[model samples]
Target: MSLAVTFAAIPYRRTGVVEMSDVGQVILCTLLLLAIAVAALVVLKRKGWLARWLGGSAILDQAPAIKRIAQTRLSRSTVVHLIEVTGRRMVVVESKSHIRMLPQDDMESHDPNL
Candidate 1:
């Protein structure tokens, strides 16, 4: 009787190097940094420092250019808005399809109460 020997090939796998808790810690740290960055931006924007740093106008500090004095809805799809900008008052007509500013002289002739 002859005895035969055979060797089986096995693949090596890496294990135990990284734990689940370590992965969880990394994710938590990333989320925390993101949240902190967002909070800082909110604080800067609310205090108007962000705009100044970016060399843009501080919208919160400036007076509004257009002010709505009055508005009247003529119909379901049409409305008239009396607006003022830089001391000049004008009537704006808005419909479903278009918006237009009425001429200054025409508005006086059309509406005596204006």
Candidate 2:
């Protein structure tokens, strides 16, 4: 009996690793993008570009009717206020989720629990 052996051929090429210049380019691009975004934010905050875009003017056209008389802070973001509008006084409650207005006749500021 006779046995024959043969080796299969392999076609492959090894490539070089990434160069330092390529890494530097990537870092430079990232820094440039971050700088541009920071600059845009600074410009928006300082120049009030967004306010101008939303139709805000530097001058007041007329006086407001709602006047704040007094305020009591209930919590960090919650407040109760006494306000007068058009000679009618009322109580207003403000919170992160809701704003409430109570009728003038229903509110008693002298009450401690109020």
Candidate 3:
């Protein structure tokens, strides 16, 4: 019996190395830097370094109830009306200004007059 030897061709993949544009490289580098910065910030926050550095607690503390009450004591619309009627608004703004009336429904709950 005679054995025949056969040679099989192997396919090789050629990788094309493409050069990136200057702008694309800059953007990519910037994004990588930003990612690194964000990662560092997250690490600092996790270790409570950020809070200590800022002179605050790591956990978000609720604002004092009295402070909230004081902040929301007067509504913006109400204060605006008071200012307009009392003529303090013009003095405060330091100019002759025409007050544009906003629709009541458009006003935000936390809108400030001053």
Candidate 4:
């Protein structure tokens, strides 16, 4: 047979172009896999199996080191908070752009004014 006839006799193969249906199927499968993984994590977390596997206490069980005792807003964008952290009480001033803490001496001086 001639080269043209031989080549023509071979089966036609489509190359390079991807169909929308094939893309949709791949996306669907990826979403299904992710959903299953998330569900498994949720179940394990509820059962505390993940904590045991990681060999430590779950982070949520520990008591917080910093606690907010009181807070007051000076204006719409500025706030003052009385907070306790690591057994030390302090005043924290927060604005939209900055945060600052008063010293212990300042706390003593300001205690009676509040």
Candidate 5:
């Protein structure tokens, strides 16, 4: 048995620096990938796959518990919504600090224009 060991040093040369076009290309590629990922995620979420992954109990056989009928912004931090649950329609006032039910007749029959 014979073993031969040989080593040769390779020469190195530096190239030109990265151009603005290169940076723009990288940024555009990154944004395109991100947009694709976001679109895919939206599709998955709408189809309830993401909900199943998150253990949200949303299944094909069952319908959603609450349905939003209408919504109005009361202020910057407050909102009023009309929602349907089971078979009842109700108005709900929601703020950052509290959530409470409102009278539908009072909200609808009482007009601010008067």
Candidate 6:
């Protein structure tokens, strides 16, 4: 039996400096501005001034439109059954042609009798 040893050569290359186009610079600037705007908005939101200017209660009420649609659509197609185990844990079974399990920890917690 003969044993052979093989050696591989490593490859390296020098990289040239990159020159960005006007569009690339504009995009980078736009992204920076967007980040700053988001930070400002977050600060304003934390201070409650954003809510005051935007009519926060109205916005919150309107935010449920999509959720209401989803719930209505799902309820029409799926049959929902609830089972309470104890304390703040409940199992919600949604069955259509198939059975699906859902945990209702928050729901049970909010229930007055729970």
The model with the greatest TM-score is 1
Off by over 4 Å in 1: 1-21, 58-60, 109-114
Q: What tens digits encode model 5's per-residue C-alpha lDDT throughout 15-97?
A: 54777679889899999999999999999999988888888755655887789999999899999999988767889989999
**Given candidate 5, what's the lDDT at residue 76?**
97
Model 2 scores worst on lDDT over the 10 consecutive residues at: 54-63
Instruction: Give the winner by lDDT.
Output: 1
In model 4, pairs of residues that clash are none
Report backbone clashes per prediction.
0, 0, 0, 0, 0, 0
C-alpha lDDT values of all predictions: 0.88, 0.83, 0.52, 0.86, 0.85, 0.61
Query: What ranking emerges by lDDT with the best candidate at the front?
Result: 1, 4, 5, 2, 6, 3
Q: Encode model 6's per-residue lDDT on 11-99: one tens digit a residue.
A: 66565355455668878999999999999999998987889788785775453321211222246666555544443334444656777
Per-residue lDDT over 13-114 for candidate 2, one digit per residue giving the tens place of the 0 to 100 score: 565476767988989999999999999988886887756666764533346788999999999999999999988999899999999998687775467575
TM-score of each: 0.66, 0.41, 0.33, 0.54, 0.40, 0.32
Which pairs of residues have clashing backbones in candidate 5? none
Model 3, range 1-114, lDDT digits (tens) per residue?
Answer: 769988898868674354455668878899999999999999999998898789787345643322111112133333233123222122111113444444334444436774
Candidate 5, run of 10 with poorest lDDT: 11-20
Question: How far in Å is the alpha carbon of 55 misplaced in model 3?
Answer: 0.7
lDDT by residue for model 1 (1-114), tens: 658877797867666667877999989999999999999999999998899888777675788999999999999999999999888889999999999997667777895765
Query: What is the overall TM-score of model 2 with all chains considered together?
Result: 0.41
